[model samples]
Target chain A: MTDWTIDSLVTALRTRRISAVEITDDCLARIDRLNPAMRTFITVDADGARRAAKERDSDLAAGRALGPLHGVPMAWKDLCAAPGLPTSCGTRTRDYFVSEMPCTAVARLVAEGAITLGKTNMTELALGPFGDNAHHGHVQNPWRSGHCSGGSSSGSGSAIAAGLALGALGSDTGGSIRLPAACCGIVGLKPTYGRVSRAGAMALSWSNDHLGPMTRTVRDAALMLGIMAGWDAADATTSRRPVPDYLQGIDRGIRGLRVGVPSNYYFDEVDAEVVTAVREAARQLGTLGARVSEVRVPDPVPLGEATGVISRAESVTIHERLLRERPQELQPVVRTRLEFGEHIAAHQYLQALRGRGRLTQEFLRAVFSQVDLLIAPTIPEPAPEIANVTTGGIDEIIKKMGRFSRLTRPFNGLGLPALSLPCGFSTRGLPLALSIVGRPFDEATVLRAGHAYEQAAGWVNRRPAIG
Target chain B: MNPSSTDPGVTAELTRLSDIIERLSRGLGLADEPASFVTVLEEGAPGDD
Candidate 1:
């Protein structure tokens, strides 16, 4: 039961080999055993989970039709608003703030019959790259207890890796979801901007923020995305285009596909071990009949800087009132970082917006013209020790912490879909991941490539030692 | 009214802008001391003939 994937768990539930109550209890027990040391969850509603499980069991017995995620237990990042739960946004200011309504993503997942397990911890205001928050204790990586679980969806990644929950929802603004997944060795998809509705999720950057799924495998991620993706009237930015059947093309191999590898920027200053894992994954893709070729990405620095400018300007606008009223309520590091946004001139923000469109077009023409998918390292290095990070030195901290998302933020700027999958373990025993980015609104290709790689490497079979 | 007739108003607005910018600079973590803020305001303020 502990080793079950989302697919296997669903099969077991249908066969009555395990009752929903039993599955819920097992997960609860695991959480009890592992969560104290791991600090993965900010809140765990054990009674609510068990009650939902019992209701699901009754529904099953009554021969009622089930949704795709029926009987599956899941959790969400604390930044997501879950009714009656404190959506703290990883800050002391909102410590007593209970959301009046559930986030649209959370509501959709719940409607699909997934039982809510709890909310996972995150960095303050979902701002930092590392997962430590003074509001809630630091969330530790499941693979190595002392290391960081990359932010700001740290708890979601740690919980899923530790088997505290089967799957979870995470928000990615500059690789928040993918970074933690890479560190924890799991699958995280940061859907194209507006691919998934951001209606009820806390806002970080209106332009760069994305809502996506974190799961144990690419297939599981696809299933979660299928349920989560769709246009919402509440969010005007959401595309009115149709959402694809992500699970429909799982068997589609990477044969005859063009896989682009960027020659510059992404590879520079990358840790040697990460480079080895990514190179090995590319070789594996080649063996699977993928037409791998070198493709040049525009100097990522300009794109990254533009993304920074836009994100900071937007974030400052979002938190202006809070920053003015309760400045001290935020973590000192997060406060200092947010304050930097005030320096962004209005013209500079406008220029970055214009540059974003030009860069996106250039990237699409250069990479997609040659390949169906672009592959790169999800992070430049393995998770660092929590104690080693110094938040006081903002520039140094941003440089080190920002490296994980350098390859990711550009895509967000362009609103392209990307998936991060665990390829191999790092030299330090932490997980190493590679991202397969696809053209805008072409998540199917990204998922197919990721599924093919998962089949070949079988890295998803490895689980952290939790209980 | 001719736009050039608003020059005196523009000058008064500039003074207000300088005062607001000085206050905002402090809030943005530039300087806490009044003298330091006045120095920044002088440097940033548009020059007069």
Candidate 2:
């Protein structure tokens, strides 16, 4: 039962080997036993989940079929608005906030026959990279309790790692999804900007934000992404392009693929252990008939600065009215950051936008010209202590957040797709991951390479012991 | 006038910008102390002069 991946679970259900209700019950039992220490969920709708499972069972019995994720129990980050669940965004201002209608992504998943377990925890206002929520308390890492679980999708990562949920939806602005996935030893995908809709999810940054899936394996992440991607009327930024069958290319081997490694900025000042692990992953790819070479990234610091400008400017705008009226409602860290956005000059914001297009074109011309994907350490180091995050001091908090997300923010600026997969574990028993980034709208290449590496490395088979 | 130019008009513009930020902080219930604030500018902002 503990060895069940989404593939194995779907096979079991299709063969009539086990009922959906039974699987739901097993998951609920695991949550009951493990959640006290993990604190992954702000709310768990077991009753609702059981009811959905029973209905799926009936459909199976009647031969009225649903989609691929039929009868699967999954969780979503609290930021996603569901009909009856609170979309708190990990802040006290909207702690009791619930929506009459579900977010477009959540509605689509339910329509595909996936059962919703409940909303998981997140960092306050989704601002900090460490998943410590002052309102709902901190979420512990499933692999090691005393350490941090990367945020603001902290609960999404921990829940899947502890088997509390089979899969989860997480929103990433600056490595929120990938960082947690790396820290929790799961597979997280940040699809190309505008590949997934951001209409109903809480907005942190209009330009850089992305919504995607986190799962225990690359194949499962691909399955969830296929269902989630598409154009939506509510979000104009969503591309009108057709959704590709992401799972279709999983078996495609990387025969002549070129993988580039950023030799300068990404490799500098990284933890020795994380650097060693990523180097080993590159070596393995080389042995598997793929060309691996070091590539230069000119001044990634400017890209990082541009990402900050856009994100902070948009965030301040989103909360402008709220900041004016209910100023005391936010956590100190979130409040200070939102206030800092006022300091961003209008011309500076516009200049950042100008630099963005030029930098993206430069990145594509230099790196993608020689390689199919770019590889780097997802995070420079393992999880830091939750207490290290300062409360009201915005500068201190931003520095801490930068440490966790610096490597991934530049890709967001370029509107490219990147996936994080566990490659090895740290000396302290935490996970270290490698990120595979692809060109715009080329999620297929990223997913294919991730799946192939996952098959060769066999890291997906290792599950954290929560009991 | 070049918006990027750092002239006396730009200094006046910075004063206005400071006023807006101060008002925003007051609205967000943040402390008005200078230590809590750090201005972020682009590489070639006129105000940096």
Candidate 3:
């Protein structure tokens, strides 16, 4: 029962096989049983969830119009405002901070009749890639104890993996969504910049920040993304383009779709097992009728460096007040991380932005014209022991942090839609992933390719040994 | 900018950005372009590209 995906739960609820209250109670019970070990949730409003479930059941009985996610139990990363719950962001600074209003993304989900379980934990201020929270407890990877559930959307990833929640909303500045999705063996989608509104979410890097869905299956991601992606008056950056029915074409097989295999950069320094898994994922796509071709992508070095410039500068600007007013309240890693961005000059930050345009142009000309989708590894290595990486001094930890997001951040700079789903598992049992990237505003293509690969690889059905 | 004003972590990051800035400046010719980060929209105007 706990292992059921969001789609299955929704089907059961609609058919009266299970009531919404029963599903909500089961999720609450699982969170109660496993959350102590997993630490995936910052708050669990079991009573509120039960109440909402009852309302949903009554609405169904009354023949009320149902949303696609009707009565689905899910959680939001603590960075998003959840009205009653405190958006702590895994920092001591906001330990008791409660949002007066709900964020646009969560509001849309609630409109669709999804019941909130509670807010999950995250890296402080969404700063670090590894989900080590000095203020809150660690979000443990359900695959193995003592291993990291890649972060800033740490708890969202862990909860989905551990079956504590059906799906979760996570924001990505760099690789916050994909890294965790990859590490925890779930499906994570980082839509093109401006595809999803960020009205009520904490701002990390305004230019780079994106809200996305992390779920157990690609179809669930599609359903959640369809609900969340659209124009919002609150967020000026959201696209005006009409939201496509992502699930309508989701089952469209990738026959004759051009798949690009990068000739350089994405695989550099990647672990052998990860490379094999990604390559095998591409091969599986080939089996599904995708035309695979090797192509040279724009050098990611400048793109990555440019991301650092823009993200750091923007973070410093956003947190300047907090840093000055109460720096000590933040996790040391997060504090130092934000502080490092203070020196980035206006000219350098601008240079990155200008380069972003040039690089996006070059990427479109060089890659997208040749292929419908590009397949790459989401991360270089499997989840490392939290004890080892988080302890090797700040400098060492920072260096390792760079590696965790090396592959994913470049796409954020390009504003391309990218998806990370479990492709295989390492010998030590951690999940490895394949990233499928598509042109701007073309997430449907990326999701379609991912769905085909997911069906072929058959990794969506593998549950972690825990809970 | 003297590197000694900040701690090693800050200095290290500054050094990295400096290298990247130098490369981006040289590799991508944007001398004529203004460096803009966020895409600003006029009131009541949609901001999709």
Candidate 4:
């Protein structure tokens, strides 16, 4: 069975064209077949999924009204806690640990009648951009074997691309969500930092972390975001601002919208194919009546560094007790990075924290003032071989990881909404993506431009030949 | 400090921290700026619209 975008699946399920049981069973069977090959899931709750799907069918037969996501089978990254299941967060330290606490993001989806297939795999502590995990193994690219899946949302990307689940919840600290989406050739959104509640998701970086959806289609992302976005007492950092109907605005079209194509920073030193594809995407958006033009981006190096500082410092704080106790249980790179974060002087960490507001102001004034949204490449290059990224020395590994995350990190620092939608494929068949970044709390516009470009390009639904 | 912090890559990140400090100290008003932290991640500013 092909992966059904939520919008399509909902209609089919509602009309009895496909039973929830049939869809769940199909996905579970695919997970069983693909999990060993690509390592997309750490666990598959087959019995639980069957039971849940049965309940959905029963509810429908009973003439009960259901939530928007009724009977939809979706996966959650291991970072999100689902009651009675382990939230491994892609490390041996917590591989067997199960949390009973409810994840606000997962609950929001489940409350809308979304059924959990299981937790998808990820990098250790949600670190690393290459989708590698010493404990979980790498989530290989679904398009082709042995290529990077673009992680720490590794398995979420692979699973969705491989059609193992309809869509999945992915968390982005630096570039986790969008990177995987780009690599797996799916759509991923890193909503503004406070746009989604992160109460029960594993916090890799307290300040930089964002929870968003990784889906097969842009409209699916809009539907999922509308379900999950809003304030929650569990996460005090959540915004009290009203969440917009993302689907309603998704098809608004980019007519007359000022779209910025970065003249610097984002395009610097990127792969030629990636640059070409995104430029072509921007050109297509222009054809759709978006007034796309080149705009100078403030030097992104400082912003990236600040984002790294905040992420590192917050990760260290989160793992302090673990590092002090069971450090050996962690992945060496994750452990090493956490160890390094300990040395960041309090004043230095505070500087990055306080500077964010002022820096975002500078960025918004210098760039966003001229454009309603900015379009850039989600990654510098297409996915590389898994061996090429994972076997390097710690220093070499860190450098490679930085390149993978560079374009996406600055947005995390700015706390802007960025959506990564597949623009085209590389010569090697790996996917490249265009990023649509909008103002804080303006995910609606971001998704709108993405949906518009996606329809014009007709690239997103061109499924990978994995299954 | 963990000895790993001495690695060149990690050292570079610390150095970037200093660069940010220097940048912020250059009349950017970092001192009076609240850490803004994660809670304030949504609103750009009251008048940002």
**How do the predictions measure up, each by TM-score?**
0.89, 0.89, 0.95, 0.96
Candidate 1 ranges beyond 4 A from true positions: A94-101, B1-49
DockQ of each: 0.02, 0.03, 0.29, 0.44
The 10-residue segment of model 1 chain A with minimum total lDDT is A93-102
Worst 10 residues of 4 chain A by lDDT: A92-101
lDDT of each: 0.81, 0.80, 0.86, 0.86
Per-residue lDDT of model 1, residues A57-89, tens digit only: 998999899888889999989888887677888
The single-chain TM-score for chain B of candidate 3 is 0.51
| Candidate 3 deviant stretches above 4 angstroms | A95-101, B1-4, B26-49
lDDT per residue for candidate 3 within A316-337, as digits (tens), equals: 8988888999988877778888
The digit string of per-residue lDDT tens for model 4 on A1-467 reads: 67588889999999999999999999999999889989999878898999999999999999898999999999999988898788778878554434456899899899899999999999888888889887877888989999999989999999999999998999998899999999989999999978899888888888889999999999999999999999899888888888888888577788999999999888989999999999999899999999999999888887677777777888889878888898889777778888877887777777777777677877877776798999999999999998998776877787888888999999888888999999999999899998999888888888888899899899976888877
- Which of candidates 1 and 4 is the stronger one according to lDDT? 4
lDDT of 2 by residue, A72-174 (tens): 8899999898877767788775544455456888888889888998999998877877888877889899888877899889999998988888889999998
Compared with the true structure, model 4 gives a TM-score of 0.96
Worst 10 residues of 3 chain A by lDDT: A93-102
Model 1 quality (TM-score) = 0.89
Each candidate: chain B TM-score: 0.42, 0.43, 0.51, 0.43
TM-score of 2: 0.89
